[model samples]
Target: MCSLAADLATLFVAFALANLLVIGKFVGEPAKPHGLVMFAMIAPVYALLAIQAGVYGIRSLAAVRETILRACWAFAQAVMLMLVIVYFGKIAEQLSRLTFVVGVGFSLCGLILLRPVMARLIPRMIGEMPAIAVVIVDSVPFTAPTGTVLLDARVLGIDPVRHDAEMAARLASAVGHAERVIVACPSERINDWSIALKSLEARGEILVPELMRFAPAKLDEYDHHPTLVVAGGPLQYRDRIIKRLFDVLVAGIATLLLSPVLLLTALAVKLTSPGPILFRQQRLGRDARLFSIYKFRTMRSDMTDHAAAQLTQRSDPRVTRVGAFLRRTSIDELPQILNVLKGDMSIVGPRPHAPAARAADKLYWEVDDRYWERHCIKPGITGLAQVRGHRGATNAHQDLIDRLQSDLEYVTNWSVWRDLRIVFATLRVLVHDKAY
Candidate 1:
């Protein structure tokens, strides 16, 4: 929260300075008040861009270079968004260009200037973190990380020779005193120790891999320490909040902006089809929960088998004339923006599958044990698979595998920037031949 406050303060100060230099009393002209409205309009853009670029990422631990880099990256992205909006909306004609550049420049400089002060004071402000207790068994070949006081695994009640009751007592004692626990054991032994460590309540308990099955696609920081997620099962609480915010903001904006097109498409579906205009189907969402996803109906209502489980193929007889055009243009998917708004789905995630979905006549879950892992996050209306042209019918085993691979890859390595890029890429796929 302090970090957010600091960034917001920095932003306003930059804006003020820019206004002073570019338009106001700095050159002896009277200060104008109209900047307030402009600030309101552009503030959130900077905030979101800053969040996406790791501005609120672990500042206490970051060096001066890292602090500057992250801030600059965020400001650059914010500027790009500002540029896009400016060009399309002709904001340049209404606002001073020098003010824009100076504000951004001041923001970057202000952020860099503050880092040293923050780095000096943060430790004192937060107080020294209770040194984490790293418990590494002898098999893992121990090296202690900086700032953490070591805890003896054997003293903490682990036995390489035999597992026993006294170990639990030691583990309890150790956890009681420690701020957190890092259990570094061999890959095979992590499960047993993880269960044990979890029983003892700690602020955080992490299992570091000596050697693990699959490499993590990304490494992120947690509590000023490096952390790795095997499945990337759930996002960091902050990232999750950001992702949800991104979904709601983007989904809401898109719906409002595309309302005319949405209405026209609905009319097209209604006029060309013999049934309902919006198609709603039950599909597995986050955590495998069934949710009703909305789309503009592109096929005749009578096609049960294909509608229920089978993927549509080229020249599929079920497709209505309007449906074909909607499918081709990908406008049929516009209604699912509601799904995104309603929290049943994300704007970017694994593509949801029908409850009875099949690939090569086998249930998708049956095809890969890792398939269910993809449900760690909400299914998306437009996903990495769809953007990668892994759309259309699923026939052979490899097609399912290919799409699943993309889905899993997306889940394993996801960030807001990555999601935005994928969502943008989905535009190309919508009109590409693969979407059919």
Candidate 2:
């Protein structure tokens, strides 16, 4: 909060100095309101970019060099964005270009000067620093650095195999108030531990030998021991923010634009079916967390499978007459827009599956170990697999593999543009032959 306040104050000062002295006095011209408009546009952009760059984070308190660099980087990007907006809006003639350049220069200088002072002052004012390091011992031999909170996974009843709300809560409680959480477990449990830690509000690492066959995003040494960063919840913090913003914006607009369709679909399901209008089923979401997914009811109430233990089949008798058309047109999945707005899912990501969902009579995770890694990000209503026509029944082992391959591919190489592309591509496959 202190950093944010100081940075805002600096920007205001820079704007005042540039407009009052540089433009009004030196240029001998009436100061136009256009400069103020530009300032308004740039301030929020700077804040968002600054947050993404970690300029107002804990690192700013400990590393002065990084703090200045990140602040400058954010400021530079904000100015560039403002220029783009001005250019596209064709309002460049409304104000003097010199004012924009001078204001940006002053703000850049102010940020560089302000960060070092805040770095030294914040700690003294906040009293004792909070715990920033934690180590979890999960039946593995390890040593922790000095002054770290250490907890035993067994004692806490934390089992990664039981990936449910109760276990997630236990893990979160054990890792409270720590900025970094490291888990030491047997090599066989590395993937399990990674999935378990993905939902926590902290950085997670696993202690493993350097020779382990794991492809980690980063590897750091702790007390001369190797620690692999296996779970960086949402990959990058900036990407998480960007993806979430995209989800909310698209989902919110979609709901507003498609309200009539949603209402008609709800009415159709209610009037045609004997049960409820919407069906809620438990499915695995991001970080292997379980969430109830919403969808228009497409099966007989007595035949509805909340656990998704039975996969839908072609010409299934359990499906109602109205349900078959809904399924065939992919209208049954429209209720999941609420799930996206509720933050349980994304607009584009690996599709979530039920805990007991299986292929070739084998559970998905049992068929392929890499399946667990797909939970690193939130599941989506439509995804790479869906658009690629890898939908419907997973009757064969290779069926699961094909979808899994597309899902992992999406997870490994994600971008906002790719998500947009997938969303557009989805429009072409809504009435696909394999939808049922």
Candidate 3:
């Protein structure tokens, strides 16, 4: 919060200076009050983009160069958004070009100047973090991380499986004020420790020597000691905020702009079929949580497959006349924009698969265990796999494999720009051969 305030302050000062010094009192001319409107438009945009770019993140606070780079990157994006809005709204003439450039330049310089001060002050403000780090040794040969307080499970009488409230409280007290707690236990006790750690306020890690085969995302360093990160949330808090914001923004706009099409589609489905206009089915979402996904009803009411036991094939007999056309043009998916608005989906992500969805004769997860990994992020109306022409029938195991590869690739390398690219790319494949 302090970081946000400091950044806002810097932007405000920069705008004031640009208006006053560059074109105001210093130039012997009255300041243009209207020029401040640019500051109003850009400040919030910069703040949101700054959060997404990690401008106020740990690395930014720790390193001056990283801080400047991230802040500038966010500022540049905000400027671009401002320019687009101005150009499209035909307000470019109303805003002074010189003031815009000078203000932006001053803002960048102000951010650079602000970093050194923040670098020194942030640590003091946050206090010495990980004020306590605890390592619990549970019947395992372990080299404790440096600067951590070591506690022997046997000596402390800490039993992770004990359901007694007193036993849980005792273990909690043992690691008071700890920012991170790493448990080194044999394979059998890992589950117990994991359950116990879930109740604690501190970040938990388990030392599993056997997990090396999987090649975890990255090894976290605890005073130079490495530990695998197996249970981290797919998106960081900042990323979740940014992604959700984008989802809402895009979904809201799409809903408004596409309302006419949606209404026509719904009316056609209702008139052509003796059932509801929407088809809702449970699909695996982030972290494998099940959520009801909405789509325009395409199949006949009696022929609808709620479980999605069978994949839709080209010219499928069950599809109604209007439904076939909707599927062909991908208009049947328009209803999912509501899912995005409801927070059950994203505008761009891996497409969700029904729980009983199969590729060939095998369930999706059975085809490849990595299939579950795609659910790390929210499912989307259209995705990397779909845009790459991997939609429709999953007739063979390899067909699922190809799409899974793209899905996982998307999950691992996600960015706002990548999402935008995938969205635009989707425009080309809306009428693809495989869609039906």
Highest-scoring model, TM-score: 2
| Greater-lDDT candidate between 1 and 2 | 2
The C-alpha TM-scores of every prediction are 0.54, 0.75, 0.62
Candidate 2 TM-score to native: 0.75
User: What lDDT does each candidate get?
Assistant: 0.67, 0.81, 0.77
Window of ten residues with lowest summed lDDT in model 3: 25-34
247 Cα displacement, candidate 2 (Å): 1.4
Model 3, C-alpha of 175: deviation from truth (Å): 20
Question: By descending lDDT, how would the candidates be arranged?
Answer: 2, 3, 1
Q: Candidate 3 regions off by >4 Å?
A: 1-36, 53-205, 209-218, 221-226, 230-234
Q: Distance (Å) between predicted and true CA of 298, model 2?
A: 1.9
True-structure lDDT of candidate 1: 0.67
Off by over 4 Å in 1: 1-31, 34-234, 304-307
Best lDDT among the predictions, by candidate number: 2
Tens digits of per-residue lDDT, candidate 2, 1-436, equal 5677789888877876787665664333544543465577888889778877877666568888887998898888998898898789887887777777888889989999998798778889987666677889989777676776789999999998865555765676677646678888998998788877766546788887754455453377456567888665445655776787789889999999989999999899889879899999988787566789999999999999998888888999899998999899999998899999899999999898988888988888778756766776889999999998899999998999999999889987898999999999999888866755
Can you list the residue pairs that collide in candidate 2? none
Q: Candidate 2: what lDDT?
A: 0.81
